[model samples]
Target: MPHTTVLPFKALLLDMDGTLVNSDAVVERCWREWALEHGLDPAEALKVVHGRQGYATMAVLLPERPMELNHADNKVMLAKETADTEGVVPIGGAPAFMAAVADLPHALVTSADEKLAQARMGAAALPMPATRVTAELVGASKPDPEGFLKGAAELGFDPADCIVFEDSGAGIEAGKAAGMRVLGVGPRAAEHAPTAVVADLTQVRVVTDADGSTSLHVTV
Candidate 1:
């Protein structure tokens, strides 16, 4: 099949979880286990956990508990997640798509801490970018525009000139708030107000410009 031609953008901002890696099962499992252990509702827990940092999600779910306890449990859950990375898959075409843009200006913006992000990406065998804005790297998480803006800054590009590939509502909100165009990944992305939405990275194509620019053209 022919690759769709992406329009040129100054830089690319990528979301780590559902966008680049299929770690949803692992995430759901860990959170469900954590919710059960904490006497929280699993469905409610999943709703709160989907796009936020683990510690932050815990705080929301268990507000009465001490922050330290939440942190400890978060660590335990993260450890379990790290050890249980068995069925991780790269989102379709992610490996080659990443390779196609490897040399370009790009950065990963994720709610996961650097450790978890690295561990998950390592398990998926996805190439890590030099610039990444992780949970620990930002004082605030997505929907706040902090991480996305920071990523654009780290890539030395203005937010208006960057394009973001994201899968979650929070990520899309962040990108939009940061003044960047967003391409939503995965089926549920319609809920997020994205400039475009596709099933996976496989539906996206990298288009190069004569001026040495690149853009992600999506098929869905």
Candidate 2:
């Protein structure tokens, strides 16, 4: 038996990787190569990769590296990631969940730039939201809260009125920092203690009220 919980919000702020889409196959493949090139352990690099822009991840893994180098290398990594979407796919129940929120107030707040975001979403067969705050739009990455804050503002909702869906520590931290209730998705997010936790989107059901209010009935 599953204990269901209902969480209400005026808008949604969504994270792409590990949330709506599972790009781990491609992500791991690319990051592994990058880690080896930089003489860092691939396993350690992977531990810091999710929910961040490429440059941010690099900075974490290579704290002594120049910021400019990280930025320049991030461009190459982005191109490589964008060019390879061989294994990109939607998370469980993501397709239906997406449709349920299609008409709702939602914005994509992702670390990936527009091109990479499009490539991954297209590969996963997920519909891209019209309101998006991509990497280029944010001066900082996840764990900094800037992207989530901007997302809430763009959707005309206060942070407290927005619900974030994420699957990584950095994203969960960002959502929390922005004062939003976060619904953690997937294994990675469980460690972060989000407002709610779900194994996947299958555990979540979105409902729209007569007054146009939206609520997520989540089975933790």
Candidate 3:
């Protein structure tokens, strides 16, 4: 076992897509298609799409379009995504890492709705947490902190007492805004403003104490 430094925390908040499941290709493809359909710029669309809910992304990219249209496009994209879920992969060390903390107090906070999150998790064969704050449950998405705050609230832990695992700029922003320490995962995660950035979950270890406090010990 690796030497671990246990920090004091009450709960864990996790980001679903990139942090847990590698759905980058799926997300990029969907956004590109939506952008083409709306005659919008793909590059610009990508900026708004990453780490945001489908409806929210569409709304930003196609602001001139009606909310109904955005919602409809989101439905179509989600349906296609949910059915064609073959490429989804679990992030490195995600399975074992999740297993290590399965019994602890944790909740998922994601820009995806419950249905889409469940679909992706199922495709990736990743375990889902009992408590989750999905897009449908929150008024705003990441970079706004609503989802993470809601997740912390649902987990019954103070924001400062929670640690968040995230893989995107928006998710990291939300975690920090919620007053939680954040661990960044994946390639571009370092630029997301997390307290620490690691290549994958394999580099991270969580230590729990008898008093139900937790600390994340990350290698690298």
Best by TM-score: 2
Q: At residue 207, what lDDT does model 1 achieve? A: 81
Candidate 1: tens digits of C-alpha lDDT, residues 128-176: 9999998878887677899999999898999888998888877788889
Candidate 3: 10-residue stretch with minimal lDDT: 1-10
lDDT assessment of candidate 2: 0.95
Selected candidate, larger lDDT, 1 vs 2: 2
RMSD of 1: 2.2
TM-score against native, each model: 0.91, 0.98, 0.91
- Model 2 clashes, total count: 0
Off by over 4 Å in 2: none
Return the TM-score for candidate 2, rounded to 2 decimals. 0.98
Cα lDDT, model 1, residue 46 = 86
Q: Over 4 Å off in model 1, which ranges?
A: 1-6, 64-66
lDDT of 2 by residue, 174-213 (tens): 9999999999999999899999999999999998889877
lDDT of 3: 0.83
